[model samples]
Target: MIVLPYLQTPRARIRLAEASDAPMLLRYREENHAHLSPWEPLREPEYYTLAHCLKTITEGREYALQDRGYPLMAFDPDEQTILATFTFANVVRGVFQGCHLGYGVAERMQGHGLMREILEPGIAWAFGELGLHRVMANYLPRNERSAKLLAKLGFEREGYARRYLRIAGVWEDHVLTARICPDG
Candidate 1:
């Protein structure tokens, strides 16, 4: 649909969500709940509800407008089903013009190179149109998929943090990685 400027892949079109897209987000959340639980924060029962998804979508849109971040959805050609979600969050400017990258793919779309397809341009937009210098992404040490993906995307290993983030319930260690703007 070309809704988002300068964001697309061969298999997916990346765009921010509209309020009406809440249903799609809800469906994606529900379908991938079990699949993504290990990597994400614990979700309360209400988090799966339509109203909550709508609220989240609204907040995400607000964040985008504020230059904070946005939940970029990678949708198939139909644009009805979500392929993946890439969020560039916690934007900090001034000397450190950077943000955090978080993402997840649909259960069915895993192992199909869909995430890379989405992120390649997503990061490019972050560094180009957004005019950011650095983009950081971290992952649980055991998440081999993430480790491989980040390495493939040229995110150099910066360091490791103990008890970095609370995933599911307990604190988990993370391997921090970052990519700088190539043109800089």
Candidate 2:
């Protein structure tokens, strides 16, 4: 197994998703389905099931072992509930040495700076341990909060893509941004 270090902030704790997290992951996705729909692709009913979550976690572990992805979960310390998820996916080595960052903060946890706290160390791990040279994050133009957060994290606006992705069953434009590894 790929062991990721635990990260703690005043309000949250971040760690890699494990097989035991399947049930909670399912609940988290089900609870946040409506809140996240506009920002994600349309999901089939089975996407929110425990079986799907289990499979996802299993695949995530295998991907991590192969150094292709890292799936992290941020939890509310007091409530012991998942407050956010961050995925560093599509990792490429050799000359590329980069990955795509995808994240979601729970509806109730928005505006709390929890995602930022979770990302700080997660990005550090990508740069420091994973040895990635760049991390890219793309967001819808309409997501002002996401834009602000990316900017705050030192991700420069790289470009805009027209019809870059299918979100909520419709083609959507995206603002691409990236952060280079400081030590690379």
Q: Which candidate should be chosen as best, given TM-score against the real structure?
A: 1
Local distance difference test, per candidate? 0.90, 0.90
The sequence of per-residue lDDT tens digits that candidate 1 reaches over residues 1-184 is 1134436678888889888889999999999999999999998999999999999989998888888886799988778888889898999978999999999999999999988888999998888888889999999999999999999999999999999999999999999999999999
lDDT of 2 by residue, 38-145 (tens): 999999989989999999999988888888888888888863689999999999999999999999999998998988888988999888878889999999999999
Q: Candidate 1: where are CA atoms >4 Å away?
A: 1-6
Residues forming the 10-long window of minimal summed lDDT in candidate 1: 1-10
TM-score of each: 0.96, 0.95
Clashing pairs in 2: none
lDDT at residue 62 of model 1 (Cα atoms): 83
Predict model 2's lDDT versus the native.
0.90
